[model samples]
Target: MATTAEYNLGDFTYPRGWFMIGLSSDATQTPLAVRFFGEDLVLYRGASGKPHLVGAYCPHMGTHLAKNTTSYVVKDGEHVQGDSIRCPYHGWRFGPDGQCDDIPYSPKAPPKRACISTKKLVERAGCLWFWYDEEGGEPDYDLPEFEGYDEPAWVNWNVRCLGELDSHPQEVIDNICDKGHLEPVHGSLNMELFENEFEGHVARQILSAGHKTLAADGGEPMTNDTWYTGPGILQSKMIGEFPSLMLIAHTPIEDGKVKVWYGLSVKVQNTEPTEEDRALAAGYEEAGVDAFAQDFEIWANKRPCLNPMMVEGDGPFDKVRIWYRQFFNPRARAGEFQKRVNGRYVVRGTNTHPWDNAA
Candidate 1:
């Protein structure tokens, strides 16, 4: 089990991006302990309905903010006070900015050093995302939004928390450009129109694929458009019988371990779908999970590819690898890497989006 640093990614151990920490429903009045980017974090929803993310330990005495076993600061069985959370050990109240605003025991004002470290947390697309950066800076880009999430015609499934896997996230990210594995790994037929576009911090892949499970009459040519907002969040829109959006996010938990989340939404034929339509949606979600599981099984069973021996038909693996490296380096060093390896690459098809009709 080699660490991420052994791959020679860059100066940073973890890539900087908007990584999915938990589901939107995970944040309640009671704080939940989350571990991502190799750090324990506290996640909770405020009275204002906004999500807050901060380091788990209390700065005063180093107590876990969300794991208090005894009845201490919890009121009504929840340890939430407006938008601030109190330390169960010493009753130190910390705000969303990770600053200690009140100390129940101390009469004087809290010291400047009594502040917890905070990260930018945003709730979108039925999930909670945190912007992680080694420099502790603002998000370089916003998370990708799906308009269907707010529309009446769309019905979403509960986010599937896949928990932690003993594998590097890079192994999963490599699947985006892995066109050679479509037939062998995922059982897709006529996997044509394999193209990838890299623009700034975003990357996209478009293809026309088909699966036997999706179409009973042999298979139909379905347009699939998959794109990554940053280094972690990948969303895909599949156009076949109905418009569908799927989300796959992988966040590093330790040097060689990663946490994954899966979610899917489908457009209803009518505002209120019939029982048949509901069954179709359920089957669609299950199919999406099974598709990802194929790659997960391979990742868990294979050795780390510190340096890959890619072939011509393997797709733009080298270019995608370099694009991914930019995140592991500081923003200042990203430009140098981008110049060396940055540009749109298209093969077997044009860069036009395949989800235009679906959207």
Candidate 2:
């Protein structure tokens, strides 16, 4: 497991960004208790079908909001009222803004001081993402959304929560610039072209992986355009006969461990998902999971690469590390770090991959 000292990220303990807290399906009218960034949070859906996230504990009586079942107002068998959530302990109702709106037993209006802190959240691309900042500010940027997420021709998997792993996210982020590890780590070979572009909080990597698995055919190299939005979300578009969108999100649960999630949406050939589409989607997802598992195995077993011994053909590990440092520091430090790492790249090479832009 890589410690913060081992990784040497920066002053901040956790990076600020819009990280996937859980799947959209994980939340309903009832609040679901979740923990991220080493803090407990409550996630629930409103009557308007919108998701809400707030500090887990109610300000009054110091009770966890999700555990308050004694005085819950249930309509349609759901514990939520409009966009408001009631504290089970004292029946104090908190609105979507985290301000106390009402007190069941009080004639006077709820005091302004009797409010709970709310976390910013956004629901997009079939996932629930929450904004986290060291100073409690708004989200720095928006999360990237895929094109055909909820369409009929796509088969969406329920979020595969992989529990917790003892590893820091920087170790996972390092994979973006690791061209040399592709063949060994994921069995992806024939890397005719591998390039990384860092623009602001996003890092893009284009890989021409010679067919090992997850390719539509057994012979053609797969051109994959993968990118990280902020510090947590990694989205990849695997171009093949049956193209797929890969969504991988990991958030720190502790100093050296993270809760990981895997999800994929497969584009079906037919207008509606048929049995054949389902089978193909299943196969594609299985292959992707297998490939990721290989990476996990290394992460779980290898010693921390805080200051890796870089050699030839290691790709831009140092450059990616510089880009990643922005998240671990305050705005002042991040700004300076960004100036050094933010830039564009057009890595070109010889390749017969169908999706290759360069000839």
Candidate 3:
């Protein structure tokens, strides 16, 4: 309910990216509703064996599509098969595209305009994504490429966890840039700080954690690049900034509720994933989870939301936080920020209000 004006102390754009709404575990035989981009959407597989995203609310009388309570029918391209979804209130039939195909009470057939809003849905890498913004303005940026994701070299495994926090999305992103907290929060991995750079809405931190070895020397800086891509996507990379080393974090907030999906990728060799590798990955992930819990505990106890009003030195990583705000601030005056040749936002200086120059 907080309008952009009310929350706008400075300009910032909403981060944008594909967010994982539900796990394969949550959506087995029934249609599941997940919230993203400030709206609830029902995700279900169509009869054609493809996934679909439909508005959660029924257009006829605003009943939730989930209220139908019927299993989805797995149909071919031609007709409805078994376990189809039907509204209990009126037996109206909706397809995976959220179309109102059958109106049992109408003798003249359902109106053509009775369909629900269908989003651009993509299912990749064992997850589902829906485009929550307008299209045709620019091609959705490609997901950062990660090496050895499906190739040979290092072992790869992933774990998806559901996290609810009483903080804003920006707060979570700050954790990625907060280098000083690594020692105290995650038990001192002896992370050594390096260069920090901000471009556009993206921030990159080059540092080395003592635990991870590089090359034959056993200790080399592990370069991690953390990016905030407009509305909700926060992505990071390890070693190098290639697409193959990518870790995507999608956080969406609606009505004071925040949901986050942490997508991680690691290079794996040809052999099976070893238990030691799994344990190490799990340990890193758990550390991230614990750190987030600490932040949630603090944010929930705060009065107003944590952005726009942060004190001068409350956050030592305030530079990164301000960079993030400038990157995503929608009120940002258009044409003021430019991208460098390397494809990062070009910062003119330390000034946060880029629009101050706007006449």
Best candidate, TM-score-wise? 1
Considering lDDT, which of the candidate structures 1 and 2 is the better prediction for this target?
1
Q: In the order shown, what is each candidate's alpha-carbon RMSD?
A: 4.4, 3.9, 7.4
Please say which candidate is ahead in TM-score: 1 or 3. Answer: 1
* Backbone clashes, each candidate: 0, 1, 35
Q: Evaluate all candidate structures by whole-model CA lDDT and list the values in order.
A: 0.81, 0.80, 0.51
Put the candidates in TM-score order, highest first. 1, 2, 3
lDDT per residue for candidate 1 within 55-80, as digits (tens), equals: 99987778999997685577545477
Tens digits of per-residue lDDT, candidate 3, 1-359, equal 23233444243224444455655445444567777657777776655656766777767887776644343322221223232455545667776656677887889777777778776666655556555442313324554333455554444436465566545565556664554454454433434443356555455655455433332343443445656554455556566422224444555656345676665555433256577765655655565556455555665575544454444222334555555443343323322432321232222111221224411
Worst window of 10 by summed lDDT in candidate 1? 350-359
What is the Cα-based TM-score of model 1? 0.91
Candidate 3 lDDT score at position 127: 59
- What tens-digit string does per-residue lDDT give for candidate 2 at 68-186? 45553543343567898887766788999999998989999998898877888888877888888886666767767666787878887656877788888888999988876787677
In model 2, the worst 10-residue window by lDDT is: 346-355
- Tell me the spans in candidate 1 whose CA falls farther than 4 Å from its real position: 75-78, 274-276, 346-359
Model 3: CA > 4 A from native: 1-16, 24-29, 70-85, 134-140, 145-147, 153-156, 187-192, 209-223, 229-231, 239-248, 268-270, 274-359
